[model samples]
Target: MAVRAEQRVDYLALDGEKSWVDFEVKVLWLVGVRGRFGSVHGMIKVDHFRSAATVEAQIDANVVSMRSKSHEEWVKSPEFFDAEHYPQILFVSDPIPLKRLQNGGEIEGTLTLRGISKPVRLNLIKPDCPGESADNCPVEAEGSIRRSDFGMSSRRGTLSDKVELSFSIATKPMNGSSAIP
Candidate 1:
């Protein structure tokens, strides 16, 4: 009898080019406010053979912006994000199955906010591939987290505990090539 060997494939590294991370939270227990971070950077690795993927990202907490300047300032204050103290929000995910992601699955990961690291599960929508290749692919995902879990407990009655997050990430091959096939 002959023994067969299993094949292993290397993951393709993709760099995030243009990405946006936004959050929506209810204020005053009724009104919804949306804000977005101005600076973001990340990298993603995809294993085509295994249909697995991993993502790591950093968001600049100080660059948060909203329609209202006062609201933006308030969010940056110690009462909320405390951007001066916590300069960055980080996220790293475990290996996620691409098949499940294609069918609207969730990615389990750890999100560090306000200097507190906690587990978070982000629900992913089917990735929208603009072209046939993997290069220049943009992905969108949404999830929510409790502010109290991250030590953001100020104004409990006025601000909702749950904060909804959404992301739009555009990726390109790390090798400085066109879309990855």
Candidate 2:
């Protein structure tokens, strides 16, 4: 009898060219401040036999774009992201059920920002075409995190500690095969 091999699927974010990681935080307890990281790269690996998937992503903190140059400068300063010290923000998810990713659910992951790692849950959105194709179709998720948890606890009364995060990306096959193989 022949043994059957386990199948796996992998997707790449295309060097993060078509990916966007945006954030919005409340300022002065009333105004909303927004910004986005310009460089992001990540990969998704799905194990068919195990019905599990994992995601790993990285963001360049040095390439942040905000509403104003002054705001951008403030974010990159030691009081915030501190790009000089920690230039990269990383997130790696625990193995999640493939069905959860397809059907839209929470994905548990650890986000490492400013050299501090914390558990975060992102709400995944179901794609338009499920189990059909991952190319062109964007995979999106959103969640919120407290800045103080990552050691950015400088401004408690001025800037809201909660940061709303939005992530979206279009992926291509990592090995020249379809999403499911």
Candidate 3:
């Protein structure tokens, strides 16, 4: 069955275990640094029959984690995310039209980072709605963005401008029941 507007799935209950948001960027034009936001919350409403979906998400910038302490601090600094000023990275899709494949599809949306919003297209892989519950679904998406476009122009030559983003989100009905882990 298709999910209606009233059946929107909540993402807050899926943090850490069932949901994750991560990114990667190259440093010194060679070294790859990977990082992940420790907290993320969102909602997704899909109209399966119409192949349409709406996604709204917020990522906690303050909780970003990296392999090294220095790297983590740098990412949260004014030159980058500036978590103190912009505590959240928000994303709201523009009534995405899903082109369903055998197991996955493509979804386009707008991502706002450091107060800058830009259009982004995510390649979904193995997105699925398990069982008969439209509220219980798993989604995976990957995309990329340019740091310079978002005003994150620090260490221009030392840090690569391209940032790759990937996320897995699982949702459950928000009818006072616990989400699946």
Candidate 4:
């Protein structure tokens, strides 16, 4: 929908200190390697009149913590995320309905990892609080991606190709602008 000048647009900044992205990949069908990315930054633009929103987020793959030091090194190595060469994982969502972000639904977007961009769909969980108030309730989402899709094809025999990702994001209004009423 065309954005009208008279329509309200609110901007929100993702709270890096409060937001986190967690991932898990099963190994040998029995073990799971779980980790989290500490540095996450993003912005959201909401057009309340259209009841839609879009978001762009960057995750610092280099700032990841795993179950152990060796696991951390392995995940950041050439076999997995390859943080040394590709330091950032990014996601830019197509305009999603505000109701999907507040209630539960699927959100389609583009995910870039190891320099490869592909379409992704994440399942959003209904928030506990009313509206899109990140202070009262974080936006929760989860999805799965194939490692081979991002060129992380090594260890296919022992490591599961599918990687599960979960995100809990908190946001603050940009420049003190409050959410649309």
Candidate 5:
């Protein structure tokens, strides 16, 4: 169903689904030779609906505007990431079917990395707290998977077998005229 333009939607709601407050699709996680970098951007869930969803994601690995602690050398390695080859990473999820949570729910979807795509899940939450940012919401979901599944097998031993994924979302109605951007 498409929401009418007259609908007083929340700007934070991403002008899409029902996600409230609009949790900034902040950062991401990647294990390097020395440690981990959780500051990459362009591939965040941001927010979602109970039965449907739209994720905020990107595919640039040159330098993450979100994470600031990553060593310049880490971003320039073949084992960590071959920015010369795989310049883009992507993730697109189906209509998030909610599974209920203490504050929200959990939904499963597919995640694409280094050009390989695989199934993954995350938490969703609602925004009812006093914080301007996404601290708590009605929906929250998370899951784990092997990086190698997506062809991101860089530091085999230095990195863990499982990658932790997390998310929180809130809705404020939409026009339904959305296609994965």
Candidate 6:
């Protein structure tokens, strides 16, 4: 029987070109505040994670947190994310399907945020390691979308409708490694 290895969310993008994909996933968001940026981080529980890979991870209000430059503005505004009421965002994928890319391969996935789920897919164009390194095979994939769909209308007039979200994550074999990224 052929061993069909499952893939995970490796990395994501910010701005347009600048991105990070070295064992970490980050969500960079822009708000109405100047010099203020917000981020969310989480690790994929690969074992608890289902393969064939249709999975849905709820970013718990307790587990996932966000930060802003000013505590007053951050705390007072429902216009911004109400971490108290709606504390979790959801990312649900339907058994990620891979399509062979011209360079390597690509994956199509779905992500849900603010109680809204949409089809999201990324191009996993690079293999984990060159010449087949299953042990330390590195995988890089990415995809994006507009935030308005989820009703994030704070900066609707100012923020770009084309909120591009992308990621680059490298997965290692289940060798009792730590999930601290």
Among these predictions, the greatest lDDT belongs to 4
Clashes, model 6:
15
Q: What's the residue-level lDDT of 77 in candidate 6?
A: 48
lDDT of 4 by residue, 1-181 (tens): 7545547788889999989999999989689889999999999898877889898999999999987899888888988889999999999999999888867899999999999999999998888875645665788899999999999998889989999999988888789554444
TM-score of each: 0.83, 0.88, 0.79, 0.90, 0.51, 0.49
**Candidate 3 lDDT (Cα, whole model)?**
0.75
How many steric clashes does model 2 contain? 0
TM-score-based ranking, best first? 4, 2, 1, 3, 5, 6
Pairs of colliding residues, candidate 4: none
Collision count for each candidate, in order: 2, 0, 0, 0, 28, 15
lDDT value, residue 136 of candidate 3: 51
Preferred candidate (TM-score higher): 2 or 5: 2
Ranking by lDDT: 4, 2, 1, 3, 5, 6
Q: Write the per-residue lDDT of candidate 2 for residues 1-181, one digit (tens) a residue.
A: 5324455455554458888899999989799999999798878777766888788888999999987999999999999999999999999999989787678889889999999999999999887874666676777899999999999898798999999999886676676543445
- Once superposed on the true structure, which residue ranges of model 2 sit more than 4 Å away at CA? 1-5, 9-15, 129-132, 176-181
Question: What are the C-alpha RMSDs, in order, of all predicted structures?
Answer: 4.7, 3.0, 5.3, 3.7, 8.3, 9.1
Per-residue CA lDDT of model 6 for 1-181, tens digit only, reads 5323432323221211121321111233354222212233333333212423233334433232224436434533465445566666555554443323214554655666555677766655555455765334434455556656666666555555555443433333333433322
lDDT of 5 by residue, 1-181 (tens): 8654334222223321322121121123343223222233322232333233345544345543223455445554565446677765554556543333334555556666666677776655543565554423434455556756866566555556565554434433333434332
Candidate 6 displacement at residue 127 in angstroms: 2.4
Note the Cα lDDT for every prediction shown: 0.78, 0.85, 0.75, 0.89, 0.45, 0.42
Measured on C-alpha atoms, candidate 1 has an lDDT of: 0.78
